[model samples]
Target: MENDQQQKLISELVFLIEKGNAHVSMEDAVAGLPANMRTVIPENLPYSIWQLIEHIRIAQKDILDFCVSEDHEKLAWPDDYWTEPVEHIDDQTWENALNEIKQERQRFFDLLQDEKTDLFSPIEWGDGQTILCEAMLIADHNAYHTAEIVVIRRMLGCWR
Candidate 1:
Protein backbone atom coordinates (compact mmCIF):
# COMPACT_ATOMS: atom_id res chain seq x y z
CA MET A 1 0.00 0.00 0.00
CA GLU A 2 1.28 3.46 -0.93
CA ASN A 3 1.75 5.72 2.06
CA ASP A 4 0.21 9.16 2.28
CA GLN A 5 3.53 10.90 1.62
CA GLN A 6 4.26 8.89 -1.52
CA GLN A 7 0.78 9.43 -2.92
CA LYS A 8 0.93 13.14 -2.15
CA LEU A 9 4.30 13.44 -3.84
CA ILE A 10 3.05 11.74 -6.96
CA SER A 11 -0.05 13.89 -7.06
CA GLU A 12 1.87 17.12 -6.67
CA LEU A 13 4.44 16.12 -9.25
CA VAL A 14 1.76 15.28 -11.79
CA PHE A 15 -0.03 18.54 -11.18
CA LEU A 16 3.16 20.51 -11.60
CA ILE A 17 4.07 18.66 -14.78
CA GLU A 18 0.68 19.01 -16.43
CA LYS A 19 -0.94 22.17 -15.06
CA GLY A 20 1.85 24.51 -13.95
CA ASN A 21 0.32 25.56 -10.62
CA ALA A 22 2.09 28.94 -10.25
CA HIS A 23 3.40 29.66 -13.74
CA VAL A 24 2.15 29.39 -17.30
CA SER A 25 1.69 25.93 -18.70
CA MET A 26 3.60 24.83 -21.80
CA GLU A 27 0.37 24.66 -23.81
CA ASP A 28 -0.55 28.17 -22.74
CA ALA A 29 2.90 29.52 -23.55
CA VAL A 30 2.99 28.13 -27.07
CA ALA A 31 -0.63 28.64 -27.96
CA GLY A 32 -1.47 31.20 -30.64
CA LEU A 33 2.19 32.07 -31.33
CA PRO A 34 2.67 33.10 -34.95
CA ALA A 35 5.12 31.10 -36.97
CA ASN A 36 7.15 34.14 -37.96
CA MET A 37 7.45 35.32 -34.37
CA ARG A 38 8.86 32.03 -33.12
CA THR A 39 12.38 32.73 -34.40
CA VAL A 40 12.41 36.42 -33.56
CA ILE A 41 14.90 37.35 -30.85
CA PRO A 42 13.50 40.09 -28.68
CA GLU A 43 15.78 42.98 -27.82
CA ASN A 44 18.58 42.07 -25.36
CA LEU A 45 17.43 38.46 -25.18
CA PRO A 46 19.95 35.80 -26.25
CA TYR A 47 17.48 33.18 -27.42
CA SER A 48 14.31 33.33 -29.47
CA ILE A 49 11.10 31.70 -28.26
CA TRP A 50 11.55 28.84 -30.72
CA GLN A 51 15.08 28.25 -29.55
CA LEU A 52 13.92 28.03 -25.97
CA ILE A 53 11.15 25.65 -26.94
CA GLU A 54 13.59 23.46 -28.81
CA HIS A 55 16.00 23.56 -25.91
CA ILE A 56 13.30 22.49 -23.50
CA ARG A 57 12.25 19.68 -25.78
CA ILE A 58 15.82 18.49 -26.27
CA ALA A 59 16.64 18.64 -22.60
CA GLN A 60 13.43 16.93 -21.53
CA LYS A 61 13.95 14.20 -24.11
CA ASP A 62 17.51 13.73 -22.92
CA ILE A 63 16.39 13.34 -19.33
CA LEU A 64 13.67 10.92 -20.32
CA ASP A 65 16.16 8.91 -22.34
CA PHE A 66 18.58 8.87 -19.45
CA CYS A 67 15.88 7.55 -17.16
CA VAL A 68 14.92 4.71 -19.48
CA SER A 69 17.90 3.85 -21.64
CA GLU A 70 20.74 1.86 -20.14
CA ASP A 71 23.01 2.67 -23.08
CA HIS A 72 22.08 6.34 -23.43
CA GLU A 73 25.05 8.59 -24.11
CA LYS A 74 24.92 12.03 -22.57
CA LEU A 75 25.03 14.93 -24.99
CA ALA A 76 27.46 17.82 -24.67
CA TRP A 77 26.03 20.47 -22.41
CA PRO A 78 24.54 23.73 -23.88
CA ASP A 79 25.72 22.95 -27.41
CA ASP A 80 23.71 19.82 -28.16
CA TYR A 81 20.80 21.12 -26.13
CA TRP A 82 20.41 24.29 -28.23
CA THR A 83 19.81 24.93 -31.88
CA GLU A 84 21.62 27.36 -34.20
CA PRO A 85 19.95 30.70 -34.74
CA VAL A 86 17.64 30.71 -37.70
CA GLU A 87 16.27 33.60 -39.74
CA HIS A 88 12.79 32.15 -39.82
CA ILE A 89 10.88 29.13 -38.65
CA ASP A 90 8.11 27.69 -40.79
CA ASP A 91 4.74 26.56 -39.48
CA GLN A 92 5.60 22.91 -39.88
CA THR A 93 8.78 23.25 -37.85
CA TRP A 94 6.98 25.03 -35.04
CA GLU A 95 4.17 22.49 -35.04
CA ASN A 96 6.65 19.64 -35.01
CA ALA A 97 8.44 20.99 -31.99
CA LEU A 98 5.21 21.48 -30.10
CA ASN A 99 4.08 17.97 -31.03
CA GLU A 100 7.33 16.48 -29.85
CA ILE A 101 7.08 18.31 -26.55
CA LYS A 102 3.54 17.14 -26.01
CA GLN A 103 4.51 13.57 -26.76
CA GLU A 104 7.50 13.63 -24.44
CA ARG A 105 5.53 15.25 -21.66
CA GLN A 106 2.90 12.55 -22.00
CA ARG A 107 5.60 9.91 -21.80
CA PHE A 108 6.89 11.33 -18.54
CA PHE A 109 3.40 11.65 -17.18
CA ASP A 110 2.72 8.03 -17.98
CA LEU A 111 5.79 6.97 -16.08
CA LEU A 112 4.64 8.80 -13.01
CA GLN A 113 1.20 7.30 -13.31
CA ASP A 114 2.46 3.73 -13.53
CA GLU A 115 1.63 1.86 -10.32
CA LYS A 116 4.59 -0.48 -10.70
CA THR A 117 7.16 2.28 -11.16
CA ASP A 118 9.53 2.50 -8.22
CA LEU A 119 9.79 6.26 -7.90
CA PHE A 120 12.37 6.05 -5.12
CA SER A 121 14.56 3.40 -6.67
CA PRO A 122 17.77 4.53 -8.31
CA ILE A 123 17.93 4.14 -12.04
CA GLU A 124 20.70 1.72 -13.00
CA TRP A 125 22.22 4.12 -15.53
CA GLY A 126 21.84 7.26 -13.44
CA ASP A 127 24.10 8.39 -10.64
CA GLY A 128 21.92 7.32 -7.73
CA GLN A 129 19.03 9.40 -9.01
CA THR A 130 15.48 8.14 -8.57
CA ILE A 131 12.58 8.44 -10.99
CA LEU A 132 10.99 10.89 -8.61
CA CYS A 133 14.04 13.11 -8.91
CA GLU A 134 13.96 13.00 -12.72
CA ALA A 135 10.24 13.80 -12.79
CA MET A 136 10.69 16.81 -10.54
CA LEU A 137 13.75 17.93 -12.51
CA ILE A 138 11.80 17.87 -15.77
CA ALA A 139 8.88 19.67 -14.20
CA ASP A 140 11.10 22.39 -12.76
CA HIS A 141 13.17 22.72 -15.92
CA ASN A 142 10.11 22.92 -18.16
CA ALA A 143 8.46 25.45 -15.90
CA TYR A 144 11.58 27.64 -15.93
CA HIS A 145 11.87 27.65 -19.71
CA THR A 146 8.12 27.95 -20.23
CA ALA A 147 8.16 31.14 -18.21
CA GLU A 148 10.97 32.44 -20.41
CA ILE A 149 8.88 31.78 -23.47
CA VAL A 150 6.02 33.75 -21.93
CA VAL A 151 8.37 36.63 -21.21
CA ILE A 152 9.60 36.62 -24.78
CA ARG A 153 6.02 36.61 -26.03
CA ARG A 154 5.22 39.58 -23.86
CA MET A 155 8.29 41.40 -25.14
CA LEU A 156 7.18 40.81 -28.71
CA GLY A 157 3.60 41.74 -27.85
CA CYS A 158 2.57 38.42 -29.28
CA TRP A 159 1.05 36.85 -26.16
CA ARG A 160 -2.66 37.25 -25.87
Candidate 2:
Protein backbone atom coordinates (compact mmCIF):
# COMPACT_ATOMS: atom_id res chain seq x y z
CA MET A 1 0.00 0.00 0.00
CA GLU A 2 1.45 3.35 -1.00
CA ASN A 3 1.29 6.14 1.50
CA ASP A 4 0.08 9.57 0.56
CA GLN A 5 3.62 10.84 0.19
CA GLN A 6 4.65 7.94 -2.06
CA GLN A 7 1.60 8.34 -4.25
CA LYS A 8 2.21 12.07 -4.51
CA LEU A 9 5.84 11.51 -5.45
CA ILE A 10 4.88 9.02 -8.13
CA SER A 11 2.32 11.41 -9.55
CA GLU A 12 4.75 14.33 -9.59
CA LEU A 13 7.47 12.29 -11.23
CA VAL A 14 5.09 11.06 -13.92
CA PHE A 15 3.95 14.60 -14.64
CA LEU A 16 7.52 15.86 -14.83
CA ILE A 17 8.59 13.02 -17.09
CA GLU A 18 5.71 13.49 -19.50
CA LYS A 19 4.89 17.21 -19.33
CA GLY A 20 8.23 19.06 -18.78
CA ASN A 21 7.20 21.78 -16.38
CA ALA A 22 10.36 23.93 -16.61
CA HIS A 23 11.20 23.32 -20.27
CA VAL A 24 9.41 22.60 -23.54
CA SER A 25 7.83 19.18 -23.74
CA MET A 26 9.42 16.68 -26.15
CA GLU A 27 6.28 16.63 -28.28
CA ASP A 28 6.32 20.39 -28.74
CA ALA A 29 10.05 20.45 -29.36
CA VAL A 30 9.80 18.06 -32.29
CA ALA A 31 6.36 18.99 -33.50
CA GLY A 32 5.83 20.56 -36.93
CA LEU A 33 9.49 20.25 -37.96
CA PRO A 34 9.51 19.88 -41.73
CA ALA A 35 11.37 16.85 -43.09
CA ASN A 36 13.57 19.20 -45.13
CA MET A 37 14.63 21.09 -42.01
CA ARG A 38 15.12 18.01 -39.84
CA THR A 39 18.51 17.26 -41.31
CA VAL A 40 19.83 20.83 -41.26
CA ILE A 41 22.75 21.30 -38.91
CA PRO A 42 23.03 24.82 -37.56
CA GLU A 43 26.49 26.37 -37.86
CA ASN A 44 28.82 25.11 -35.12
CA LEU A 45 26.23 22.62 -33.87
CA PRO A 46 27.64 19.11 -33.87
CA TYR A 47 24.37 17.30 -34.53
CA SER A 48 21.57 17.91 -36.95
CA ILE A 49 18.07 17.98 -35.48
CA TRP A 50 17.46 14.54 -36.99
CA GLN A 51 20.52 13.12 -35.26
CA LEU A 52 19.42 14.59 -31.97
CA ILE A 53 15.97 13.07 -32.32
CA GLU A 54 17.36 9.64 -33.12
CA HIS A 55 19.83 9.93 -30.24
CA ILE A 56 17.07 10.82 -27.82
CA ARG A 57 14.99 7.88 -29.01
CA ILE A 58 17.90 5.48 -28.67
CA ALA A 59 19.01 6.68 -25.26
CA GLN A 60 15.51 6.72 -23.85
CA LYS A 61 14.84 3.23 -25.15
CA ASP A 62 18.07 2.00 -23.57
CA ILE A 63 17.15 3.37 -20.16
CA LEU A 64 13.63 2.06 -20.34
CA ASP A 65 14.78 -1.39 -21.42
CA PHE A 66 17.36 -1.47 -18.65
CA CYS A 67 14.69 -0.75 -16.12
CA VAL A 68 12.45 -3.59 -17.28
CA SER A 69 14.63 -6.25 -18.91
CA GLU A 70 16.67 -8.70 -16.89
CA ASP A 71 18.93 -9.63 -19.80
CA HIS A 72 19.29 -6.26 -21.55
CA GLU A 73 22.66 -5.54 -23.15
CA LYS A 74 23.82 -1.96 -22.81
CA LEU A 75 24.51 0.02 -25.97
CA ALA A 76 27.97 1.38 -26.67
CA TRP A 77 28.23 5.00 -25.62
CA PRO A 78 28.25 7.81 -28.26
CA ASP A 79 28.39 5.29 -31.09
CA ASP A 80 25.20 3.29 -30.67
CA TYR A 81 23.44 6.28 -29.18
CA TRP A 82 23.91 8.59 -32.17
CA THR A 83 23.26 8.31 -35.88
CA GLU A 84 25.48 9.73 -38.58
CA PRO A 85 24.33 13.07 -39.95
CA VAL A 86 22.47 12.53 -43.19
CA GLU A 87 21.78 14.74 -46.19
CA HIS A 88 18.10 13.91 -46.23
CA ILE A 89 15.44 13.17 -43.62
CA ASP A 90 12.57 11.04 -44.78
CA ASP A 91 9.12 11.87 -43.42
CA GLN A 92 8.49 8.24 -42.48
CA THR A 93 11.72 8.01 -40.50
CA TRP A 94 10.94 11.28 -38.70
CA GLU A 95 7.48 10.09 -37.76
CA ASN A 96 8.82 6.74 -36.55
CA ALA A 97 11.31 8.49 -34.28
CA LEU A 98 8.59 10.64 -32.79
CA ASN A 99 6.36 7.59 -32.33
CA GLU A 100 9.17 5.67 -30.66
CA ILE A 101 9.72 8.42 -28.13
CA LYS A 102 6.03 8.56 -27.29
CA GLN A 103 5.85 4.78 -26.92
CA GLU A 104 8.88 4.65 -24.62
CA ARG A 105 7.57 7.52 -22.56
CA GLN A 106 4.30 5.69 -22.11
CA ARG A 107 6.14 2.53 -21.03
CA PHE A 108 8.03 4.43 -18.36
CA PHE A 109 4.82 6.08 -17.24
CA ASP A 110 3.15 2.68 -16.96
CA LEU A 111 6.02 1.38 -14.83
CA LEU A 112 5.69 4.32 -12.49
CA GLN A 113 1.96 3.92 -12.32
CA ASP A 114 2.12 0.21 -11.53
CA GLU A 115 1.11 -0.17 -7.89
CA LYS A 116 3.31 -3.21 -7.37
CA THR A 117 6.49 -1.63 -8.67
CA ASP A 118 8.86 -0.89 -5.85
CA LEU A 119 10.32 2.49 -6.72
CA PHE A 120 13.24 2.07 -4.32
CA SER A 121 14.25 -1.48 -5.16
CA PRO A 122 17.63 -1.59 -6.88
CA ILE A 123 18.01 -3.64 -10.03
CA GLU A 124 20.25 -6.61 -9.34
CA TRP A 125 22.00 -6.19 -12.69
CA GLY A 126 22.65 -2.47 -12.26
CA ASP A 127 24.98 -0.73 -9.84
CA GLY A 128 22.61 -0.01 -6.96
CA GLN A 129 20.31 2.14 -9.10
CA THR A 130 16.62 2.25 -8.28
CA ILE A 131 13.65 2.70 -10.56
CA LEU A 132 13.15 6.14 -9.04
CA CYS A 133 16.68 7.14 -10.04
CA GLU A 134 16.25 5.83 -13.60
CA ALA A 135 12.96 7.69 -13.94
CA MET A 136 14.60 10.94 -12.87
CA LEU A 137 17.53 10.35 -15.22
CA ILE A 138 15.20 9.76 -18.16
CA ALA A 139 13.26 12.93 -17.35
CA ASP A 140 16.40 15.04 -17.05
CA HIS A 141 18.07 13.60 -20.14
CA ASN A 142 14.96 13.99 -22.29
CA ALA A 143 14.40 17.56 -21.09
CA TYR A 144 17.99 18.54 -21.92
CA HIS A 145 18.01 17.08 -25.42
CA THR A 146 14.50 18.24 -26.17
CA ALA A 147 15.63 21.78 -25.35
CA GLU A 148 18.57 21.32 -27.69
CA ILE A 149 16.18 20.37 -30.48
CA VAL A 150 14.17 23.49 -29.77
CA VAL A 151 17.30 25.63 -29.96
CA ILE A 152 18.21 23.99 -33.26
CA ARG A 153 14.77 24.79 -34.59
CA ARG A 154 15.13 28.38 -33.43
CA MET A 155 18.52 28.63 -35.08
CA LEU A 156 16.97 27.46 -38.32
CA GLY A 157 14.15 29.98 -37.88
CA CYS A 158 11.56 27.22 -37.98
CA TRP A 159 10.16 27.26 -34.45
CA ARG A 160 6.98 29.32 -34.21
Candidate 3:
Protein backbone atom coordinates (compact mmCIF):
# COMPACT_ATOMS: atom_id res chain seq x y z
CA MET A 1 0.00 0.00 0.00
CA GLU A 2 1.11 3.56 -0.52
CA ASN A 3 2.56 5.31 2.52
CA ASP A 4 -0.15 7.95 2.41
CA GLN A 5 -2.92 5.38 2.25
CA GLN A 6 -1.41 3.34 5.07
CA GLN A 7 -1.08 6.42 7.26
CA LYS A 8 -4.66 7.40 6.52
CA LEU A 9 -5.86 3.94 7.36
CA ILE A 10 -3.99 3.95 10.66
CA SER A 11 -5.45 7.31 11.62
CA GLU A 12 -8.94 6.12 10.78
CA LEU A 13 -8.56 2.89 12.68
CA VAL A 14 -7.29 4.70 15.73
CA PHE A 15 -10.26 7.04 15.61
CA LEU A 16 -12.64 4.13 15.15
CA ILE A 17 -11.27 2.31 18.16
CA GLU A 18 -10.85 5.26 20.51
CA LYS A 19 -13.23 7.99 19.42
CA GLY A 20 -16.28 5.77 18.87
CA ASN A 21 -17.05 7.91 15.80
CA ALA A 22 -20.54 6.45 15.39
CA HIS A 23 -21.50 6.06 19.07
CA VAL A 24 -20.44 6.75 22.66
CA SER A 25 -16.90 5.92 23.57
CA MET A 26 -16.44 3.22 26.19
CA GLU A 27 -15.13 5.69 28.73
CA ASP A 28 -17.99 8.08 28.20
CA ALA A 29 -20.55 5.29 28.48
CA VAL A 30 -19.16 4.37 31.89
CA ALA A 31 -18.41 7.89 33.04
CA GLY A 32 -20.36 9.33 36.01
CA LEU A 33 -21.89 5.93 36.76
CA PRO A 34 -22.57 5.53 40.45
CA ALA A 35 -20.46 2.94 42.20
CA ASN A 36 -23.55 1.08 43.39
CA MET A 37 -25.11 1.14 39.95
CA ARG A 38 -22.10 -0.49 38.36
CA THR A 39 -23.08 -3.85 39.81
CA VAL A 40 -26.82 -3.53 39.38
CA ILE A 41 -28.19 -5.89 36.76
CA PRO A 42 -31.03 -4.35 34.85
CA GLU A 43 -34.18 -6.42 34.44
CA ASN A 44 -34.05 -8.85 31.51
CA LEU A 45 -30.42 -8.03 30.82
CA PRO A 46 -27.86 -10.78 31.21
CA TYR A 47 -25.08 -8.54 32.58
CA SER A 48 -24.26 -5.55 34.74
CA ILE A 49 -22.06 -2.57 33.83
CA TRP A 50 -19.23 -4.19 35.72
CA GLN A 51 -19.63 -7.42 33.78
CA LEU A 52 -19.74 -5.57 30.49
CA ILE A 53 -16.59 -3.59 31.23
CA GLU A 54 -14.77 -6.71 32.31
CA HIS A 55 -15.86 -8.49 29.16
CA ILE A 56 -14.55 -5.62 27.07
CA ARG A 57 -11.28 -5.67 28.96
CA ILE A 58 -10.76 -9.42 28.62
CA ALA A 59 -11.66 -9.58 24.97
CA GLN A 60 -9.59 -6.51 24.07
CA LYS A 61 -6.57 -7.86 25.89
CA ASP A 62 -6.95 -11.25 24.25
CA ILE A 63 -7.07 -9.71 20.79
CA LEU A 64 -4.11 -7.48 21.57
CA ASP A 65 -2.10 -10.47 22.69
CA PHE A 66 -3.06 -12.39 19.57
CA CYS A 67 -1.90 -9.55 17.34
CA VAL A 68 1.40 -8.92 19.14
CA SER A 69 2.43 -12.42 20.22
CA GLU A 70 2.95 -15.60 18.26
CA ASP A 71 2.25 -17.82 21.26
CA HIS A 72 -0.99 -16.19 22.31
CA GLU A 73 -3.42 -18.72 23.71
CA LYS A 74 -6.95 -18.49 22.44
CA LEU A 75 -9.54 -17.98 25.18
CA ALA A 76 -12.71 -20.08 25.28
CA TRP A 77 -15.68 -18.25 23.84
CA PRO A 78 -18.36 -16.80 26.23
CA ASP A 79 -16.63 -18.42 29.24
CA ASP A 80 -13.20 -16.82 29.38
CA TYR A 81 -14.47 -13.64 27.76
CA TRP A 82 -17.07 -12.74 30.39
CA THR A 83 -16.26 -12.23 34.04
CA GLU A 84 -17.90 -14.28 36.79
CA PRO A 85 -21.16 -12.58 37.78
CA VAL A 86 -20.32 -10.00 40.44
CA GLU A 87 -22.69 -8.15 42.71
CA HIS A 88 -20.11 -5.72 44.03
CA ILE A 89 -16.80 -4.08 43.13
CA ASP A 90 -14.55 -1.75 45.08
CA ASP A 91 -13.47 1.56 43.62
CA GLN A 92 -9.90 0.38 43.22
CA THR A 93 -10.92 -2.76 41.32
CA TRP A 94 -13.18 -0.80 39.03
CA GLU A 95 -10.50 1.77 38.32
CA ASN A 96 -7.93 -0.94 37.68
CA ALA A 97 -10.09 -2.71 35.12
CA LEU A 98 -10.84 0.53 33.31
CA ASN A 99 -7.16 1.43 33.28
CA GLU A 100 -6.28 -1.98 31.88
CA ILE A 101 -8.69 -1.45 29.02
CA LYS A 102 -7.12 1.88 28.17
CA GLN A 103 -3.64 0.44 28.37
CA GLU A 104 -4.47 -2.51 26.12
CA ARG A 105 -6.15 -0.22 23.65
CA GLN A 106 -3.15 2.11 23.58
CA ARG A 107 -0.94 -0.86 22.82
CA PHE A 108 -3.12 -1.69 19.86
CA PHE A 109 -2.87 1.89 18.66
CA ASP A 110 0.87 1.68 18.94
CA LEU A 111 0.86 -1.44 16.79
CA LEU A 112 -1.15 0.36 14.20
CA GLN A 113 1.14 3.37 14.30
CA ASP A 114 4.25 1.33 13.72
CA GLU A 115 5.33 1.91 10.16
CA LYS A 116 6.77 -1.59 9.85
CA THR A 117 3.63 -3.39 11.01
CA ASP A 118 1.89 -4.77 7.96
CA LEU A 119 -1.82 -4.30 8.43
CA PHE A 120 -2.91 -6.55 5.59
CA SER A 121 -0.51 -9.47 5.76
CA PRO A 122 -1.90 -12.71 7.17
CA ILE A 123 -0.72 -13.58 10.64
CA GLU A 124 1.73 -16.41 10.39
CA TRP A 125 0.46 -18.54 13.26
CA GLY A 126 -3.22 -18.22 12.45
CA ASP A 127 -5.35 -19.76 9.72
CA GLY A 128 -5.67 -16.52 7.76
CA GLN A 129 -6.02 -13.46 9.95
CA THR A 130 -4.48 -10.03 9.57
CA ILE A 131 -3.87 -7.07 11.80
CA LEU A 132 -6.52 -5.24 9.84
CA CYS A 133 -9.04 -7.95 10.65
CA GLU A 134 -8.15 -7.89 14.31
CA ALA A 135 -8.42 -4.12 14.42
CA MET A 136 -11.93 -4.22 12.99
CA LEU A 137 -12.89 -6.95 15.42
CA ILE A 138 -11.73 -4.91 18.38
CA ALA A 139 -13.53 -1.78 17.25
CA ASP A 140 -16.76 -3.59 16.41
CA HIS A 141 -16.76 -5.68 19.57
CA ASN A 142 -16.07 -2.75 21.86
CA ALA A 143 -18.64 -0.53 20.18
CA TYR A 144 -21.32 -3.22 20.52
CA HIS A 145 -20.64 -3.65 24.23
CA THR A 146 -20.41 0.08 24.78
CA ALA A 147 -23.87 0.45 23.29
CA GLU A 148 -25.12 -2.28 25.60
CA ILE A 149 -23.69 -0.43 28.56
CA VAL A 150 -25.49 2.71 27.49
CA VAL A 151 -28.72 0.78 27.10
CA ILE A 152 -28.35 -0.69 30.57
CA ARG A 153 -27.73 2.78 31.96
CA ARG A 154 -30.91 4.00 30.30
CA MET A 155 -32.85 1.04 31.62
CA LEU A 156 -31.65 1.76 35.15
CA GLY A 157 -32.66 5.41 34.84
CA CYS A 158 -29.08 6.54 35.15
CA TRP A 159 -28.38 7.81 31.66
CA ARG A 160 -28.52 11.53 31.05
Highest TM-score against the true fold, candidate: 3
- Identify the superior model by TM-score, candidate 1 or candidate 2: 2
lDDT of each: 0.88, 0.89, 0.93
Q: Candidate 3 on 23-133: residue-level lDDT in tens?
A: 989999999999999999888888899999999999999999999898888899989998877879999999999999999999999999998899999988877999999
* Cα lDDT over the full model 2: 0.89
Error of 2 at 61 (Å): 0.7
Can you give the lDDT of residue 151 in candidate 1?
91
Please rank every candidate by lDDT, starting with the best.
3, 2, 1
Residue-pair clashes, model 1: 0
Model 1: lDDT of residue 51: 93
Report the lDDT tens digits of candidate 1 across residue range 71-93.
Answer: 88789987999998899988888
Which stretches of model 3 miss by more than 4 angstroms?
none
lDDT of 2 by residue, 1-160 (tens): 4488888998899889888789988888878887789899889989998898898889989998999998887899879999998999778878888898889989988988788788998987899999999999998998999899999999999998
Q: After superposition, how far is residue 33 of candidate 3 from its true place, in Å?
A: 0.3
Tell me the deviation in Å of residue 134 in model 3. Answer: 0.5
Ranking by TM-score: 3, 2, 1
